[model samples]
Target: MLEEQLLQRSENKCELCQSGETLKLYAVPPQSANNVDNCIIVCDTCLSQIEKNKETEKNHWRCLTTSMWSELAAVQVVSWRMLNRLSTEGWAVDNLDMMYLDDETLAWAKAAAEDENDEIIEIHKDCNGSPLLAGDSIVLTKSLDVKGSTLNAKLGTVVKNIRLVENNTDQIEGKIEGQVIVILTKYVRKQG
Candidate 1:
């Protein structure tokens, strides 16, 4: 439904240049949100150009000075996003102070831009260079001084039943001397 509305608003045209070749929705700068207000119909050419000249954010968004002054929410949001990305430039930084949005609308724009910072599942790599899976026993090849506690994990110590960190791809959770902590997978080797 949002896609359909976007198509209708842009009149099946690329909202940026009024071009009609294969209209697509562009979410300004932050790509996490893909929707009507946060997105505008664009074409493949514009998308690739944006990616190619990513280092030149100022020139890429020179079009926004005119586009930013528009009343459309999509336009405003796109302008806001682009300007924010280009905020490093002097002109874009000045525009941030000039740009104004009501509380409700500004809130919507921000909510749509919140990128997901989720946890990733991680496994121990190992001191011997082996991937440690869950339920596998491992031995610490090197001595480690546990921080913030008085647990001394000695070298050649065997730690059993290692738990892989759910949010990190290169770590495991294991208890040593009644203390639980994160251990780098590369420092642990799988034990039979």
Candidate 2:
């Protein structure tokens, strides 16, 4: 299995801090594939510290100095990100300056920084401010005209198995009258 392969690659130790206790697979974010190139084996302490907010402990991440030079792209990416976060620390800033990633890897690291800057995770919500999830049915609170078609979705119309639109919190896709259409979240209400 992939887990075993990862375990073998890391020699049954955490890739970051080399701790064998409580090891788990950590997938590098914004990755399309869940393969070894995009995943790293890490211990619980390293995982929790990496995922923590801006107030993370500076001493705990000194291990990055070694992990930053890892052969794996995923490890390098994570190291680059952590180093960037801790750049305010003099040692971290020096490491960031010394670290070298290929163009593609550098782009991936920069993308993570951009995502962190936009900290508000956008979520689809109904007119009543209730959260919407994929596969949840919703009722239209206001009638809407189907763009590029003659179908007029009536008020109180139920849309089943809704899919949230990526990058747009105010829209969702649902089937109405056997045709899939984009419905504004503001005109919908979560169904019981």
Candidate 2 to native Cα RMSD, angstroms: 14.7
Model 2 global lDDT (CA atoms, 0 to 1): 0.86
- Per-residue lDDT of 72 in model 1: 75
User: Model 1 over residues 1-192: C-alpha lDDT tens digits?
Assistant: 777898898788766556678766666545465766567777665565544443443565777777777777767765665566555465765676578877865665565555422111222357654555677788887788888887888887788878878767578878888788777776777786
* 58-153 per-residue lDDT for model 2 (tens digits): 897899999999989899998988887765466876687679999999888778767767242455778976778899999999999999999999
How accurate locally, in lDDT, is each candidate? Answer: 0.67, 0.86
Q: What is the TM-score of each candidate against the true structure?
A: 0.44, 0.59
